[model samples]
Target: MIRSTFVRTALCALLAPTLSCNMLDVNDNEDVSGRGARVFDPYQSSDSGAIRLSLQQFNGCAILPSGSAVSKGTLNLPGYPDTCPDLLAADPTSARSAPTGTLRLMAGTRYFLNQLTLSDIVLNKHTNGADLTDAVRWMKNESRFRNLDWSDLGRVSDQWTFSTGIEGFSQDAWTREVLFDNARWRTVKDDTFTVEIIDQDGVTPRMTPVVYSRTDFLADSAYGGHTRVGWRMETVQAPQSPGDVVPHPLPVLSGQPASPPAYRTLVKIEMVGSTNPFKTFEAPFIPGPAILKVTWSQLPDEPFFFPIELVTPEGLAPTCANADGQPVACGFGVDPKFKFSTPANGQGYYEPGESFRLFLDMRDGDGNQMLPAGVLPSGKDMLADKANGLLYATQASYFTLLERDSLPAYMVAGPLQKLQVRSDPQAKAPYWSANAESVGLVDSLATLSAFPGVYGSTWTTRYSVNLPQDAEPGTYVALVKTQRYFLGERVAKTNSYFFQVGQQEPTTYPNAVGNCQLCHRGVLSLDNLRHGLGVDHVEACKTCHQRDSDLVPRIQTLIHQLHNSSPRYTQNKTDCTVCHLTKESALRPSMNVCQSCHPSVHGDEYFATQFSAKGEPNRFGNCAQTCHAQSTTNGHILPEN
Candidate 1:
């Protein structure tokens, strides 16, 4: 009995002391209380109980879970020996495959009894700076291994045998593929149940560190001279029953010398973030004999941004709002001028006779309002003039309109001057005062009154055009615009406000956008040069165009100068049709209009004796005599002869 107790105690202390000492406490009654008894059962674990695990990770990137992979090239510490050496004992030339790169993992060690089990390894992830990879970033309050894959790679014993491959150094071309993939680039991943070990007692274990370079190695403090996980048993628990004097299959059948339960551990992993944008995949594994830690790797976040809103308040500005043309909060005229949009459906019933504020909002493709300029200084007046007046030049606003017609000459018209407004996206419209559907879709007007908001600013520049009570009864469109001049000359968004008088009209400003955009295409914001004046869907020039008696800029000439009169408009421009918004024949009002271009075609000096077939005096030269300068008749106006 004495010998049996000694042998069992020795074995228990050698292999697993946690459960080793408690195995003998099955007695119903005993005075073993004074025998220095402390219960530690590795096999039993519960939430908020004993038998806890503590994982200490070395490198920030190393605590990653298996199946964690890196990309195309390898990342090696300077002067470190190359990876994957002597990986093939079966090779004739004994070639060692270079690792694409190295990956880190949550690992721990135990050398108590020369027996290492999952229970011995407490992934010390609970420590500070445990994880650095984007795949996993745990904060102070959150660090608990919830999903773990525990593997029991047999045991390493006090014996000897070394030829080619060691215990857990899983290698081969196949292993390389498993580690990275066929894409032989220097890519790597934490795909294996990779384990690197060093005896806590300083006694060398098994396997060997794969080496191609002999200089330096992994920066992990614990990863200095370690070998891959490889175990060979020096001693294993005998399957015999402890009470039996003779060994028999009976104890084996009864499951003597039971192993500890597998640890279902919790490991934090971030699947995607930063440069590593990878899709998720699973690693192959066999069920081990313990439960402890849980592993996690989640998807990364997406492109993020916040846009600005322009505020345009209706009616006269509040007395305080007139911040000496400086940026005040506009209608609110105070702080918290920072505003988001209100998603709305129905705006008020607007008619020509009624007056209202002109407003607008600029957004990204998602319709999310964006801050077009720098953020205002904490207490800066958003309603006051910013940057001594011209800072708003960056996000400046221009108003224009086009007259709508039945079979119209143009689609829209005029920077209709018939309303007043305060500049502020947060400012409200009396007609649009109804509760909004959602928020953040700002139909607003914003300014760079606040310092550092943007290179430019835009405010509520309103007009009070009297829609003649007797004016033509039809619909008109007003286009609210913010030209991207200071940076790139591009229109930020398309916001057109429409109102009707009697009925809605259909108008076609054929190819206005197509033609005008040709020369107006570049957005050069960095320079001071003024590019072509930008045109929006709202041809607001019609408001001023109604009284054009001079042809110095027949509307066509007005547009010509806007383009800096690029040859596309003159010099090489011979086609009059390019500027006309009409049927070819309808363009000619009379012969006098033609004389402007073909002045030589008419004159008393040139056609003094000329007369038509009738014996009357000819007021102007005939098409053949003056209009067609060619010796022969010009194209189709005159006969071929």
Candidate 2:
């Protein structure tokens, strides 16, 4: 197969010079770029940003190849020893040389990086053969580069600048690039640099270079603020165009070629400097959970350097403290499962005009309160705490209450009722900044309520909401979504709880006939449901997708139509058991539900003729009790599994 691929590629190459070998990559397949044209936004181009490089070289100075030197004495560049030995110490002659390489820069830093922006920006455009790795696949199809596209390709703040004030870096200084619209990139860690060595042929591996800064090793203390480092790659041979044909001997049969093509990508560091000088002495560290201390030096032969300063202050590390200025035990950020506890509370019974309170807590994986009940990181202490690391610094929080119904309905009817943010009485001011012009403080907590503790991770929050005068008497789902900055990355947590109004033990719709989690897990979780409301279950879907949902179809009708057309539903879509766990419970005869699968049943001719004997104008009445009661299960087939 390898030989066949090589032979085919070689054959295509041979015929390329004289003829248009467009079939080499077979363009007859679906045009991926064209298919995605309607949604393509020119401004959404990921590589639209650029970075500039200015190499700093002091001639006659005994600088190490790593771009570091101590008053000039000896110069070493490995394999090229004595390259600049016995250099003058006071040599002031300096020249900046623009080396030949490709400078690559990505937008945003780790702390502020946004995945949605990264998802849109694709770094590599090549998509032929092995290069077609990033192409989207159907259900259960795993690609080797599954996560390659989701890397921290931060949105470039401008055409040139990118910030480095990430998790481990200081927030004092940032490049000129303004972080508008919540755009972000990956945080810069100590070993974030991608360094590679190549042979003369450009296809062979060489030795890795030691990367460091002029003042000290590439540590957290050296990388905060506006510190920036640009990367460049120099290949031995220029990149070959897809249409270019390379002359090579024909390959032997049985997947063996005379010479297999290889590539050597040598990373060359051309420039390393700061966009601006450091301004503050405070750097954010995660206390004992994520402390960073640099204790390394650069080698004389290493060929890259950035200037970093060690900020010194008494007790620079921020400790978790209570509002009374006493110390407390705490960690860095919220856990993936931040909504630790939300009891049913048996508060299902409520009067139409009466109000009810729902309580919940947002905790970390270690069962620690999101924010200390009595302890608060605010004012100068908050700043000092953030200089160490932030905890529960919410960027935004949304609470949506939806009333349940036997059938889906529009918002005005009875589906969506309320949307609130700060509902807890103890919640003081808004912790997030909704203004595009303002930057949110990294130390603000989501809920500062000092509510009494119940669970080990108790940070209980109370949500008070009143029922409408004509409110329905069924279950209500309250979705609480909180977005915050944790260890420099913007993370979100969503929790949904069910309660009743004007009823004893709220009733469920039983619309969730199937175990949808079988397919909708992990990356394909229900968070993608209905504009990302974090509705993790199919049952929660009925709240918004009502029978009178205005522009959208009902949940039952929508699910049937969606799965029928979905390419991922390889199983017999019409099979009742695929979605319906039990036929007797879910397979009720209803013209409204059946027409979603068989639209022909909605016509006047079918309804009139089919129900002529029954003497009915339309089949809107009791569908099962009339003619189709027993026949409802006739056409449906059961799955062997």
Candidate 3:
């Protein structure tokens, strides 16, 4: 009998295209509705007195005629286990009432529904009883309507109220607070009783009153104070479903991708001086100056590839100019003051993101060499600490030697000593010059080097060369060299700077106008239902739909006057959608799909609304009658001939 029933059902399905179910649940008792059938016990074995069907015959069922004979041996229904779990029937009574107050809804449900209803009520009241079809149309077009879920509504501040009791006898307490502790409710209007009920016990029940309130939906708060950018809500938790894991593993490699070869640029050089005559000279043999130390710190994050070549300028040899302005040329002696070039070469490559240092050695005119006092000789390399109170060094090789015998030695010294004395009665000499300027080293060097035939007085100057957009991405070493003139030759070659250049990503909408998405994307948290002059729609429209020169001043004055007028004024509206639409509608205004009621506020009208098109009307009659009727003479009256 069951096999015959299955055959009959299959024939009915094939002959009448109205039936949609692929499997029938014979064990279930639920009535089939229209052409739909309830599938029950779909896993029953064919040999257990059920339909013993062959795969080929079953597949050909749709092609067979209603009265055709079934080839019993060829008919087959594969024994594959069902992938879908059995679905339980929903309670009829439970379906009539709203789902549990605790049931969370998808975002934007409460806001969209509330706004739609409120807009309808406000429009009807202002339009002198105009039908609510337009308002309904707008709500249906809203983007959030389709995506809303139960959880979203549950999160609304005051989304609950009392309705009739389930059995029609008792009073049901349906406060939103009972459903959600955090929910808040604000009464929009006084409660009104809608219907009375009678219970199964034949007792009469009092009528229940209906009330309305708007919900405070949760929104992302991180961008609350940023008026120029828009923010969207994101889920804080990942999906807990077991099947959500990725099946494929991420690729792993041992090394980074090969980058293009790095280019080289020169960094600057620094020179330092050792002991002075006061610290090194004895009673008879006048001690010359000490050693000059030169060092340089490579750019912060550049790779060093080439040797730093220090090229000293021609003949103006390195010399010490004493207080009497006489030059003492200290040649290749243990601490000669004359300048010499040093080649900077090292084997190791500088890491792409690390900083390094380079150092140069030189002697003073009197052949006195300076001992490395800090990190250099000790190999501690503390050069990165700029505030460590160590000796100051510069790119240029410069220094001065003062007479240690001078105490005001000018008055007591002999003629030959005086000729070589180099004393400045008004000047305290080299060491004192260090204290004369705010920029300690630069100023001191400039001051001490004011003497004739002396070139060790000042440090080299540096200038920055800005990088262009098309410049290569890899690091380029920049070397700065400067020269100083002594009696005749360029004695010093100074070098400084190790740095990297970063490229900025190009903008996709470089010419985009005002931050329209700031409010349009629902990031501003304003009352979505409130119609206003500066709402997202109007703000976006103003981007391209600017008024003409002749009309701009007038429109501006009119708009400002309208919004600032008396609150009771009937015609005081300035919303921009009154005259715009996807296409013109006989009953209501549209801004095209772009300016449609929701989803996106941009569409075809965006291109058409440009100032060059001059498409928008100049006068405010239509807009005032629709959205700004409150500012009109009759306040809420529709236009009359």
Candidate 4:
């Protein structure tokens, strides 16, 4: 929401090259090697260079049914004061032993509620902003947690806790982990069922159980703070006749009442039913209580910490409905096909300051056509207005032009030059016009004719971009990402398009500085990089990571420091070649890069003084001129391999 009074088109002048806008008579870009400019085509589906499309999805907490009981209060124990308190008592230093609490089961159920658990919790936030120590501590603690001994710690069948689950798989993918052995438990039978809450130390016991009502638990700041906090009924046993009231006691101490005096709840118990694929363990409890029918969708709409899935489209058509609401076949696959269609007679080549138009054939990841195409019920060609342009259907609302502020195209000059959307400021045109598109349709009558009124086709949703008059001449890359609805799920994909502008040969960026595979190993594919683009090489990351005058050093510094702080990165801290592919690339260090590793050697003031020589600080700011020289390599111990 950074609103700017400056016109959007006027902003283009700030980024485009100084060279005059002019068309190239021919494609002189030798780097292209005579390759056709057709990067993606849904109809052909045979272009090896087509940007890979993957489904975008995130896994969310499986919501419980409406009447289920969950903890609702926060417990502030001693030691850690205001950082982030817990809903349950988590004071590890407390010396209390086997503190008892009562549990009551209402009548009409066969078994009484036997197991109680404090589940779905995250305690600490490990951040690497101003202090690197927090991140380092997080890594170490995570390692210890992953390797903890279950036998020695003792298991509490009903209890579960969550973690950020760094460096490995998590039940909810970076969201939750089952902290089964973390809790200590004791079982006792009083007038009503009761259990003892134990401290994590395996020695000190809690004074009294801290159980919050479902409402209070959800209201705590930490309840929705990081992940979620709530207790679970892990197991149940013993038959109780109708109307039998078994009491569970949770008393108020200094601050607030642990929970209400009494509240009826519907609990989902372990039973013979479809299993949750994400759960790590099988049924820890025997069959008890009635099972509730629940449903979930693979479609990921809700945002999680980091939510995006990368996978090649299977081209599998999903079941869809026609405009008439009748069942129909959605053509095939959700990966939208794209290709340049503007600047006619240019042989797929573009020039500076040219009208650029690209065609995107929209499809739901499931084969449903997103935009209306084919023949209408009136027997008129759906694309009859191709001479002009067709308006998008209401469903087009699902399509989003990501990175609206900054146009997706980048000029691969000395550094990455962000291309702006062409605008007319003098005419008072909005600066955002560069990202604006006059939506149109491409003829798909050849194939879509058969699916008349079925609400689908191999039609293209067109976008027209007017390149700035002073647009730089070089290879231009457009990383297009669009999201659409697929069946009941939200799906998206990102693809890269390479086209020449202003005739310098279309050479790829010199991004071979780092040997990413040395550490990433077999997982260094495009999907693993997870930046959305399908290009296998790391340079594809530059699409967004390109040096921005405003946000350059922050990312570089964080990345460098994060790697140096990782417990898993065992290489010598100064070993540049471990990641750098060539000695020259490693030797060409900038002040920002050096400072990331040697924070204690100098202060920000000194770095800024050196950058003053280059006018304004940017990605190219270097220390070699003012301080570090060739001898800077002498400080590092290079591997002999």
lDDT against the true structure, each candidate:
0.22, 0.28, 0.19, 0.29
What is the lDDT for 2 in model 3? 12
Candidate 1's residue-wise lDDT over 1-641, tens digit each? 00123343335434542221211211211112111112211211111111111121211211101101111122222222342222112210123343332221112211011101111111222222112221122211232221222222222211111111112321100000000011111012332212222222222322232111111111111011112121111111222222222211111223234222111112212111001101111111112211111211111111000011111223223322222333322210001111111112122123444443332333222222222233221112222222111111211111000001000011123212221111111233211211221111211222223334431333332233234344444334543322221100111222333343333232222222113323222221101011111233313333323221221123332343333222123423434333332333222222222333343444434333221111222222233344443453222232111
Candidate 2: tens digits of C-alpha lDDT, residues 114-175: 11100011111222222222222310033211222233333222111111122322221111
**TM-score: which candidate is best?**
4
Scored by lDDT, model 2 comes in at 0.28
Q: Which segments of candidate 2 are over 4 A away from where they belong?
A: 1-349, 367-463, 468-477, 483-485, 488-492, 498-512, 520-537, 545-568, 581-641
- Candidate 4: minimum summed lDDT over ten consecutive residues — where? 395-404
- For model 2 the TM-score comes to 0.30
lDDT of 3 by residue, 274-380 (tens): 11101111111112211111111111121111101111223223243333445533221121111111111121122222222322223322322222221111101
RMSD, model 1, all Cα superposed? Answer: 39.4
For residues 403-476, could you state the per-residue lDDT of candidate 4 as single tens digits?
A: 11111122222112232211111122211123311211322122123435533433334556677777665555
> Which regions in candidate 4 have their CA more than 4 angstroms from the true location?
1-337, 362-462, 468-474, 482-493, 503-506, 519-524, 547-555, 568-573, 582-584, 587-591, 598-620, 637-641
TM-score of each: 0.24, 0.30, 0.13, 0.38
For model 1, state the Cα shift of residue 319 in Å: 23
- What C-alpha lDDT, on a 0 to 100 scale, does residue 368 get in candidate 3? 24
